[model samples]
Target: MNTQDRLIESTRELLWERGYIGTSPTAIQRRAKAGQGSMYHHFTGKPDLALAAIRRTAEEMRAKAEAQFSVPGTAVERVTAYLRRERDVLKGCPIGRLTQDPDVMADPVLRAPVDETLAWVRERLTSILAEGRERGELDVAMDPRATAATIFAVLQGGYVLARAADSVEPFDQAITGVLGLLTASTPATRE
Candidate 1:
């Protein structure tokens, strides 16, 4: 890849592996195999490069979700597909992990992408749930906004729990628990 591309990609990897505080400009240069001069030439500094990387990561996450949501299925089925999508469970979420970093959370510029990505996920989930209720797949009384937020929170919490335990079992259980609750709320379950 070109120098600019290499720098952004390296930043993305470093940010995923190490938060903003952990990823130094020197480390990015070394990882990208580009000289300091080259990095500075293409980008103003670390923040600029990091923003680019974060934006890319956010877009990728959205695209991945969209792929599952766009598929032909009932709301619950499509959401189940999203929840069951293959992921590097042990590695944790690339974007969600950033929220734990003090530096990332402290800087509005650095945190915007993380915040926006999560909001997008919650909003998408809410819309899906609303559709489910409209179609009578879900109970009409179910609150889409509340349910979506819960789903998002549970997923993120699952990552933290799994990472803490050093096993994917907790994460899988969390998913199963949420899915079970969602299914139980569906009309099919009542019928």
Candidate 2:
């Protein structure tokens, strides 16, 4: 990778491993194998590089979600695929973890991507549930917005629960529970 790319990638990994307060310019340079001069030449400073890294991470998260959503399946099935998608459950979510960082949440510039990514996920899921309801795949009484929010909450909460217990069982159980609830909502014929 080029100097700039290396710097951005290194920052990304560092940010994931360490929050903004914990990641330092020296550490980024060391990880990237780039000297101070190269880093400054490629970017204004740490915040600039971190922003690039965070945005890249958010973009990748969106693209990954889109991959699942675009597949041929009913809304619940697509959502199930997304929930069951392989992940490093113990490591927690890259973007969701940022939400816990005081520095990241305190700075609007740093928080924008994290907030936007989460909102985007919720909105996308809402649309999918709405579509399913319209198609009679889900019960007409189901509230798409509410259901979408519930699913999103369960996912993030599951991550927290798993990490707290140092086991993937919590996350698996949460996914299974949510999937069961969703299945219960399906139209009788569809079920």
Candidate 3:
């Protein structure tokens, strides 16, 4: 890859492996194999490069989640597909993990991508639930926005629980529990 691309990519990986405070410009340069001058030439400094990397990660996360939503299925089925999608469970969420970083949370610029990504996921899920209700696939009484938020919370919380326990069991259990709740509430199953 080109110098700028290499630098951006290296920063992305480093940020995922190490939060903003832990990732240093020197480490980025070392990983990218680019000189300091090259890095400065492409960007102002570490924050600028980190912003680029975080934005890229956020975009990728959105695109990946959107793919699951786009598949042909009822809302519950599509949501189930998304929740059950393969992930590096122990690695935690690339974007959600940043929410815990003091530096990332302190800077609005750094936090924008993370916030936007999560909001996007919740909104997308809400849309799906709303559509399902309209189509009678889900119970009419179900609150789309609330259900969406719950589902989003379960996934992020699952990651935290899993990482804290150093096992994927918590994450799997959370998913299973949420899936059960959702599936049981579907109109078809309810009737």
Q: Write the per-residue lDDT of candidate 2 for residues 9-64, one digit (tens) a residue.
A: 99989888888999999999999999999999988998889899999999999999
In order, candidate lDDTs are: 0.93, 0.94, 0.95
For candidate 1, give the lDDT of residue 45: 94
lDDT of 1 at 75: 91
Q: What 10-residue stretch in candidate 3 is worst by lDDT?
A: 182-191
Q: What is the TM-score of each candidate against the true structure?
A: 0.98, 0.97, 0.98
Off-target runs (Cα >4 Å) in candidate 1 are none
Error at 59, model 3, angstroms: 0.6
lDDT of 1 at 163: 91
* Comparing 1 and 3 on lDDT, the stronger one: 3
Return the lDDT, model 1, position 103. Answer: 88
Best by lDDT: 3
lDDT of 2: 0.94
The TM-score measured for candidate 3 stands at 0.98
Better of 2 and 3 by TM-score: 3
